[model samples]
Target: MQLLLAHVTGIQLSVRGVWELLRTHGWSCRQPARRAIERSEAAVAGWIKETWPSAKPLPRRSGPGSSSRTRPLSR
Candidate 1:
């Protein structure tokens, strides 16, 4: 069980040990497909836009003397 978890996380594990475990359990795991990557990216982007619609237009800062001049901060 520990070896299987390690394999899924891409951490170092004894190949023989994991192979034996899989053979005993008759199971296997494969890497995610390209379609899954695209779906996940789209889902995240949608969630961000839905959650923060006002965040699209970021606030602008005033340039020096563009408005009323303010005193510079002292060290």
Candidate 2:
């Protein structure tokens, strides 16, 4: 759950937040290092999976001077 929250939300919520949420629900906090290690491993595994050979190439941009309507917006 914490791993999902951290990955999906992209927020590095503190250990205190995790502890408080668990405590509120009458659950005990797991070791902080264990949680951190799990999260880190999950993140690395995700990255590896995402960057594997099957990954699609990013779309190429048209590059500089490719557009004709170039007047500055501020002017």
Candidate 2 lDDT, tens digit per residue, 1-75? 677769988866677887787789988746555355446776778888887646877778664543447764342
- For model 1, the stretches where C-alpha displacement exceeds 4 angstroms are 1-13, 31-45, 48-75
What lDDT would each prediction earn against the true structure? 0.68, 0.70
Task: Say which candidate scores most in TM-score.
Answer: 2
- Evaluate model 1: give its TM-score: 0.23
Tens digit of per-residue lDDT, candidate 1, span 1-75: 665577788765577776776778976677645565346876788889896677678778655443435865444
- lDDT for predicted candidate 1 compared with the true structure: 0.68
Model 2 lDDT, full chain set: 0.70
Which is the leading candidate under lDDT? 2
